[model samples]
Target: MGRGARETVLGTLGKATILQIPPELQDLTRRFGEAVWKRDTEDPQRKLVLLKYLDGNYTNYMQERTRFHKSSFSLEILNTSRQERQLYEFIVSKGPEEKVWQIQLEVYEPVSDPSIQILGWALVNDSCTITLNCTAERGDNVSYSWGSWDTSTSGLCSHNGSLLYLSYPLQNTSIACACTASNPISSRVVTFNSSECSYEQRGKFPRTEHLVLLVVVPIVAVIIITGVFTAAHLAMPIAKQEHLPLAEDSAVHTIYSQVQRVESPDKEPTTVYASVMMPTA
Candidate 1:
């Protein structure tokens, strides 16, 4: 038969075999070719070409199209939505022999900034604890890490999962902190001011100072009041007495009476004398 006639027959046979393919299989095949072709446009020199087999025997056709076969097939998917599992079938002798293969294309977006929250903290102690949670709208095998960034240094602490617990000293006001979310495909980082997670170092005087004031002030006040009462008690006189005597002498008589002053334990006592006279009848 002539070459043209042989090609016509082969084409007819190939079409009939394709018509017999299941709808699902046909869809799979079409999607595979489309994905490969889209990849080819970006790099025409690395086009993917499938082998054309002869009669249902691999031995007969294996060597015939060695030069026509592509080195390998690769698809570059820019968009994650476009990634999918693809099927391709290689037919020999118009359908008597066939081989099927699949290509799995996975495209994932980079992780976005993680959500951060302060669980609790102690400012006076200069310690803070925070939680970093990372998530992606479309990604798999995501991971998280925590770190501190300052003018002096940047250090990272690794954690295996999406959530990370970070506890660090908030010693410097200039330091900043961040969480990094990553996947096998890509990574992203989000930063925050350290002050956001830290407590205001309890001002100059903390709760301890207030507590000291509460305990010390009353004691001091009691001491001052006691001192004042003791001083007043010591300054006042204990007692006072006055006496007058009458004598029956014809002439005037003078008698001296001694007045004694009581002394405090802390002071010396004082004394005074008064003269008394009696007129006789």
Candidate 2:
């Protein structure tokens, strides 16, 4: 009827122990009481369920322990009537107490899948093979399987264990490598791109450029060799010519002049000098 009456009846009922309150309903009543009275008593108070139903519906209540602070309580209804279908939730420290009344089951979220890293790479023949290492990020502990790329062509490879395989034909391509992780609640996928691998890069050499360089190198070598041989042959004659002395007699004869003397001799005979005799006794 009212708060005072309800408390009195509860006290009397407790003393007689005549009413057969089911263990579950009794726990609910106790939680309800704590949530109410604690709100009326303290600065910061605890909260509890105020009402519950099997169908999806809920009501909430709040009571302030002090003028400035309050404790709150809520009740949520799951739509399903199935007894087996339970919702899991976390409660502040009093798990055992809350479980008895609320019937709130504990549930876990699905774990995230495992991811891989390329530790090393090797080129076999013309094809490239990658070595992978992996780690799992999970809610609950899980194991992993690694495998080669599947027919579906999803960037991911099937997993047998952490060891997986990927084969790329000797060509240029962006290949996808994937790792899958699963747990009871959920599964996740992680992929490593081929480009991330150190040796995964395919280097290309131009066929035309290679041919051009090959042809040019020998031609240059021949030209250099021919030039060296010609210089060696010419140097011998030049050295011999440098060692020979110049003729001095040939130079004097080149400068001398020859005279025809007939007329010129007559003119020269006309001029004679007189000599004076000195007295001797």
Instruction: List the RMSD of every prediction in angstroms.
Output: 24.2, 21.5
Q: Please, what is the whole-model Cα lDDT of each candidate in the order they appear?
A: 0.45, 0.44
| Top-TM-score candidate index | 1
Q: Which residue pairs does candidate 1 place in steric collision?
A: none
What are the per-residue Cα lDDT tens digits for candidate 1 across 1-281?
11111111011111111102233433444434321221122343563443332222112121232222222222222222421222322321213332233332333444555666543333436665555555545445567676655535364344556565656677755656566777765677776565665454444223556768988999999999999999878766542223334444567868888887977877777778898887657
TM-score of each model, paired residue for residue = 0.35, 0.31
Model 1 lDDT vs. the true structure? 0.45
Per-residue lDDT of model 2, residues 12-36, tens digit only: 1111111121344434544444322
The most accurate candidate by lDDT is 1
The number of clashing residue pairs in each candidate reads 0, 9
TM-score: model 1 vs. ground truth: 0.35
